[model samples]
Target: MTPDEVIAAWDQPGATASIHPTRGISEGAYWASGEAQAALLAQDIPAGSRVMDFGCGDGRVAIPLRALGYDVTGVDASPNMLAALNRHAPDLATFRSDGSDFGKHLGRRKFDAVYCLAVLIHHSHETGQQLVERLRAVVRKGGILVLDWPVADEPAETNAWIGVTTWSRDQQDQITKRLGLTRLDVDRPWAVYQA
Candidate 1:
């Protein structure tokens, strides 16, 4: 699907319902390992630091980080998603923007850290490069950027809904290098880069 189509699908009624709280774990838990991962990421950053969760669907990561006392902002292409996020996290800030061009929506704002999880794989290679550049522009020097997406040795496969494009380690290495980012960690699908 095109980027607009993907956004429309996500904004449809009940599109985000499945991600809401379940019987045991809450929605945030179901999305980001029950907030454990978010806590880990927030551990090093001092309280009140600014963080942005790019493609921050329904506050999965943003809410938890906010709860940890960081100034968190959730950015996504879907207003419906941002609305849903507001319902759960009313005080958290949100902005509407596509993954490939969030810097424009943010104006001169920069973040101490950025989270772009489960987002990059939906874009083609060219679009992904644009997204990396935009994301880089928003992150402050010496800040961190966390990325997590499926990776495989096989060629990337695009679905009828949100297209999926997998990247190999080499591809990711080149991206970090081009962006002048230092790799801090590499655990399978997750890579932490310091700008």
Candidate 2:
């Protein structure tokens, strides 16, 4: 599905629940390992650094990071999802934008670290590349970009609520190389890159 279609679907009633039936909220709200992510992030980023949660759905990562004392801003395409996040983290800054572009919503602001977790699978390879380029532009020099997506031996497509695409390790490597990003770590689907 197109990004617009995906956003429309997420805005529908119970859409968050549908994506995370057992958790009863979007995956971001109660995803396991929030502490682990926080710990990992703290190793490189100091407390109170500015962070951006790209494709932040329902404040799964942003809230925990905020509680850890980092200033966080979340950007998402679904108003319903952002509303859910607002209810949970009322003080957390948020903006409405499809994951493909951040400058359109967040102008000249740059982040110390930007994370796009479990959100890129829904985009096609072309769109994912575009998103990486846009995200790179918003990250400060020597900043971090953390991305998580399902890994496959070859590029593959799936039909869930919307069409989802997975990129292979080689594909991901090429993307990072093309963007002139240095790969810092790769724990399977989760890869950290430095700008």
lDDT of candidates 1 onward, in order: 0.76, 0.77
Model 2: ten consecutive residues of lowest lDDT: 20-29
Give me the candidate number with maximum TM-score: 2
Candidate 2 residue-wise lDDT, 83-130, digit = tens: 989998898999988755565776787998888876777777777777
Q: Write one digit per residue (lDDT tens) for candidate 1, span 76-102.
A: 998998987899889898889985556
Return the TM-score for each candidate structure: 0.85, 0.87
Native-to-model Cα distance after best TM-score fit, residue 133 in candidate 1, in Å: 1.6
TM-score of predicted structure 2: 0.87
Segments of candidate 2 deviating more than 4 angstroms: 21-36, 162-164, 186-189
Count clashing pairs, candidate 2. Answer: 1
Question: Residue pairs in steric clash, candidate 1?
Answer: none
